[model samples]
Target: MGSAWKQLPEELTGPARSLAEELRTLKDAAGLSLSELATRTHYSRASWERWLNGKRVITEQALDALIGAVECDGPALRALWQQAVAGPSGAEAGAQDTAAEADADADAPRVAGVQDTAEPVEVLPAGEPEPATAWWRRPAPLLACAAVVALVLVLVGLRATRHDDPSTPVADPGTSSAPVTVPAKPVSSDPTCQAMGCAHKNPKDTGCGKDARTLQSDVIGKVVIYLRYSQKCQAVWAAINEGQPQDYATITSSTGESEQALIHYGYDNYSLMLSAADPAVTFQVCGHQPEGNLCIAPMSDPAGMVASTPIPVGPASPPPGVGGTASPTADATASPSAAPTAVS
Candidate 1:
């Protein structure tokens, strides 16, 4: 009976067909019968006929067997086999088949029918599976959520701190802490000082002048300094309240001096005067002044003469005779005979 492989179409053309043609050419060139080729390749005659006739796809092992039977170049035939399996048709496939045949002519060995056992096929490695992930597991989305949560936590912490802590104590420009129970240092009395409008005849008098005077007498001869009118005053006051060392300048000025005098004295309200000659000079700062001036009032020595020496600049020390022995007190004995008695 004719071979069942004969059913292959005459027009069947591709890498597979090209491989079959090369096998046939190899057999003819070697002048070998099917039985002889099969014996040399260690394959059955039927298997050889079927493979060469293109009845089944040729495997690399089978191609290797055929190369031995025909004494053909193994590398050339193996290369052509690889191309044939890669694609069914293409110019490259044809070229590869042609090159294989040319190489086979040069190196093939003659063979008579012979049979040899086939080698066992090796198992292929299994394919790896893809890793699983959830929709929210994407790196970008996770990072964005983390950032938002951090921001929210920060905002919440800040809000809670603001509410729980005390309100920032407001220190007036030239004044100490905001006036809570006591009013700020007196600036000017009501312009209308008629008894009906303001009880004090001198509108400039602070209502607590007596109290201030009493405090001054007790601390006399100690360096008494006050901050002038400026943002710097607020800073100094804050520092003082904290019990930190602070340096204050003592300014001495008369009532009738020009506004420029206040500026030179580093005071906002120049209405207040400092008695450089007072055993202990008193600074009645205008806690409030439209022009933002710091008024200085230095009670004169009992004799009513201004002291020629400037007040020293340093941290405020405890009053003499109160905490410890007094530093040589300014001539407190200077008589106040000509000094103004009324604070106003």
Candidate 2:
């Protein structure tokens, strides 16, 4: 993937082509394969490849991730990406909208018997006058007094309750009046979603957890992904190993609700932190083309999924979604099968 590569489309002139060229150059300088890039960045490798190949425009998120990956924080690159995304298509869409509006106006119905019976609305009194006080600024001392009394009653009730319970220590009258401190989310350092820890707890806990269940992969395509769920965590996450640039994968629930994640040019591997998608609704994973064709081709349907009991990970499995793998894009790019060209 060295200097020589497939040429960009001739139609991709102007900002769009400039952006694509710059992205490729930046990725090369970073010295990371597409797969490695995807694992490190939020955007997937497949998505990035499409942008670099001039198949589609990249998103601002993609540019941001690319900037981070290359360790270069430049405003010019962002501007270029913006221009590319807002290319001819944007202007065309605007023109189309304008034409539609004009056509609607021309076709509007008119009746000869119609009469203009409209009335003018009154304007605000313009005479000079003193402005009234704002609602919050009004004199409300009695309201404040009532609120303080209510607070005191609540605190006193608690104090009396504690006093009645000999085992409970009554809060001292001199203690800080600030609200009592309470831990926000019950967090645990252990990644394992144990029954006790995950009970009534959020799926994404403090640390990376063990794989509670592994999904079977039947369809193999440009991208190969595996799903794993932790009953304790009550969550499902995926680790994708194989994929070309611009490939995207989506997880849809039994109810057709879905969450979509994208792959960028150098992105190879990815793992999703399951949260929104509910386990009660059976979920399916589908891979999509970076440009389109989402879920059009999928490895397997989620219908096969069943109630999985807690199966703690043994010594056989290491990382979360099977073992993460790499892509071959970089290897081909380094030697640059053809001529070296400048994007900027």
Candidate 3:
């Protein structure tokens, strides 16, 4: 952890650099120690160090692992990572090609205009043979080629380390709460227990029902409001979804049960799962390490829902950009109407 804690300090430009930075940020948001990450992912700590160094391009496998482990938006991160890996190298190659062509135009002699019917003349010194035509043999083109080669070598060197050790293997859903049919056996699979009163159970367990969907919160900083409807239990509860490193959201029912979740994967929106709460409920979103916990509570809703029109919320705003105060009946915070008496 000593040297691993320190990030790569070299000045890297383009996609590799950006990808490296995002990977480090993802690790931070996950809150897992390097040793723990090594254990969970079955990857060596040294391998992670290389991955974060910005010298080598991360493969799809590593990228997938980071996405799944952190519960991030996979498509979004994959797009960014692809840009970083392909962006710089392709750009540099194109740039070099353009520069070499430009140098040839500037350095080589050219005719003003010659028609295909006219014969071109080749001028050569009395004792000189034709020069080598290899593009890299020229001064300007050679320099450009050298630069490209150096970069390729650096990237290759980083990846070559992987071949040096072949032990690590890498490989790599939000929607709504709707009425679910209760199976006679009530087979619980992937239940997300998110509230204070809700028992945290595995989605695979036979407790929390299967219905899941994410609702948008209408606010300055887009908040994530997750809804879970359990048919077997015949109850529904809402939980705050978070993914940023600092910000969080929570809700408390009139019965005093509260559920909270931290932001995830540098995402403005996060996912949360909770068992339904008793009575009416209220919610609050807050930030971390501030002098005080400045939390904003959204409108509370009756356990039994009312006929209210859905007020759609947009992509969440960063916590600092948020405005206005939380309201008890704010359209942004929609509460669920119902829950089963017992999850079993």
Q: Residue 24, candidate 1: how far off, in angstroms?
A: 0.4
Off by over 4 Å in 2: 42-47, 89-234, 237-344
lDDT (10s digit) by residue, model 3, range 1-344: 11233444343444456567667655644555554454333233333554565434454544654554553445656665655544534223211223333454345322111111232111112443223222212124554455455545544543454345454221110433321221122233443344443443322133342332222122222333333334333333333322223555454444455555443322222223344444354444343322334444444442333224332221111111134422222321121111111110
C-alpha local distance difference test of each model:
0.31, 0.39, 0.36
Q: What is the TM-score (0 to 1) of candidate 3?
A: 0.30
Per the 3 Å backbone cut-off, how many clashing residue pairs does candidate 2 have? 27
Per-residue lDDT, model 1, residue 121, is 15
For every candidate, C-alpha RMSD to the true structure in Å: 50.7, 25.7, 21.4
Alpha-carbon deviation at 258 in model 2, angstroms: 9.1
Best by lDDT: 2
Give the candidate number with the greatest TM-score: 2
Residue 184 in model 2: lDDT: 21
lDDT per residue (tens digit) for residues 95-186 in model 1: 12233333442353211111112221111133442222111022245544654454355434434543455542222437543222211123
The clash count of every prediction, one per candidate, is 27, 27, 27
TM-score of each: 0.24, 0.35, 0.30
